[model samples]
Target: MASREGSLSVVIPAFNEAGNIGDLVIETIDAVPASLLREIVVVDDCSDDGTEDVLKRLSVTIPALRYVRHGARAGQSAALRTGVRTATAPLIATMDGDGQNDPRDILKLLAALEAPSGETVVLAGGVRTQRR
Candidate 1:
């Protein structure tokens, strides 16, 4: 197990994903251990739907949940960059908001990074074989 120093931040970039955002947020919160998670930052790319409202409500319920809405519609990459820029944690873990990525994989990635090894690994990630 890795040390729970509140060092990791989860950044989710969403665009018009009102239907999936709330569940994803709740699932992400539940998947990550409280001690290891510093915060969860959701960057909304000017979603026309109710994603902003959902995030606002979730933020009130989850202390670690923070969100930012772009003034204009930006693509997913731009949303990710914005989230990364706004994140406060040194270690950032990014995931899609459309529920394509598994929240539990975050722990696996963290464990892989923390594992002792003679050779350095630059990154650890899982492939998404099935799209929802």
Candidate 2:
């Protein structure tokens, strides 16, 4: 379990995913426990499909939601790098803004990391049964 209320920050790299980004963020917030969640950082890659507008609206209602928009249209890797850099939580979990990745898996991965298996576990990754 996270030692504090805000230990996990989910970094989502989004580009023109305005249609599903809100749903993804809302689903993540609902699926992850508040005690372990710190924030959801969505780094927009200069999406022209009103992604910034949606993020702006969501951020106002969700204090944990942080929005970072790039002035130019950077690729996903750059957006991911930006998000990871901007995140404040000690632990960072990453997922797609299109809702392909399951937010619920975050808890399971965290459990594996904190299991104290008498070995030095640096990271845990979840493989989806059906890769979409």
Candidate 3:
């Protein structure tokens, strides 16, 4: 695991993903080392399928888990923007809320950022072949 002075904030944007949100949150917490992660922010875009309830319940179990809900149904970009705005960490990581993203990838990105390279790399990302 890579160590950093600041923690990483994970931002996830969700719509009506009640079925998948719980497992995603748990997996994300398990995948990220506690020392490296600050918090997991899930932005709910006015999901009607009890997504908020799931997040609230998960928050009780996971101290780092928090969520914000939009009053009206907003687009994915809006939800992501809200999550980023609410994040407290200096470094931010984003993922899909459909549970298709692998949390291990967040660690790889963090490692790359922490790596000592002469050239400055602002960001690193990749596409997963598998789809939900």
Candidate 4:
């Protein structure tokens, strides 16, 4: 059991996810409770597919949404690093920008943590079955 309750931040590393980023962010926001959600940070790896514009438009309606862009193209690791560093919440949940991750699982993952024990939950992986 987690000893202390803290807000959550969702981080996404994106390259060319303009078509998917909007729906992903909206789904994530809907899944997380407003009280527990700190913010959702989307890090753009210098995508040329207008991902930045998508995020910019979404931010107007959702105050909890924030985004950062890399001046040059970087890998996923660098984008993840940027998102984590930009996140303001103590607890951060990372997912793919392509919307493969289900936001509904965020609470379940948080429930599995034991923050007071000085323990860290590094990777929580899931399998995707019956791909269409």
Q: Is candidate 3 or candidate 4 better by lDDT?
A: 3
What's the lDDT for candidate 1? 0.89
Q: Estimated TM-score per prediction?
A: 0.92, 0.93, 0.92, 0.85
What is the full ranking by TM-score, best candidate first?
Answer: 2, 1, 3, 4
Error of 1 at 34 (Å): 0.3
lDDT of 4 by residue, 48-111 (tens): 9999999999999999998899999889999999999999988889989998888888877776
lDDT agreement of model 3 with the native: 0.89
Model 2 stretches with alpha carbons more than 4 Å out: 2-4
What local distance difference test score does each model get?
0.89, 0.91, 0.89, 0.87
Clashing residue pairs in all predictions, respectively, total 0, 0, 0, 0
Query: Residue 17: error of model 4 in Å?
Result: 0.4
| Candidate 1 error regions (>4 Å) | 1-4
Best TM-score among the predictions, by candidate number: 2
Q: Which pairs in model 1 have colliding backbones? A: none
Q: What's the lDDT for residue 115 in model 2?
A: 57
**Residue-pair clashes, model 1:** 0
Candidate 3: where are CA atoms >4 Å away? Answer: none
- Model 4, runs deviating above 4 Å: 1-6, 114-132
Better of 1 and 2 by TM-score: 2
* Candidate 3 residue lDDT tens string, 1-132: 454644789999999999999999999989988888899999999999999999999998799998899999879999999999999987899999998999988978876765486777778777888876
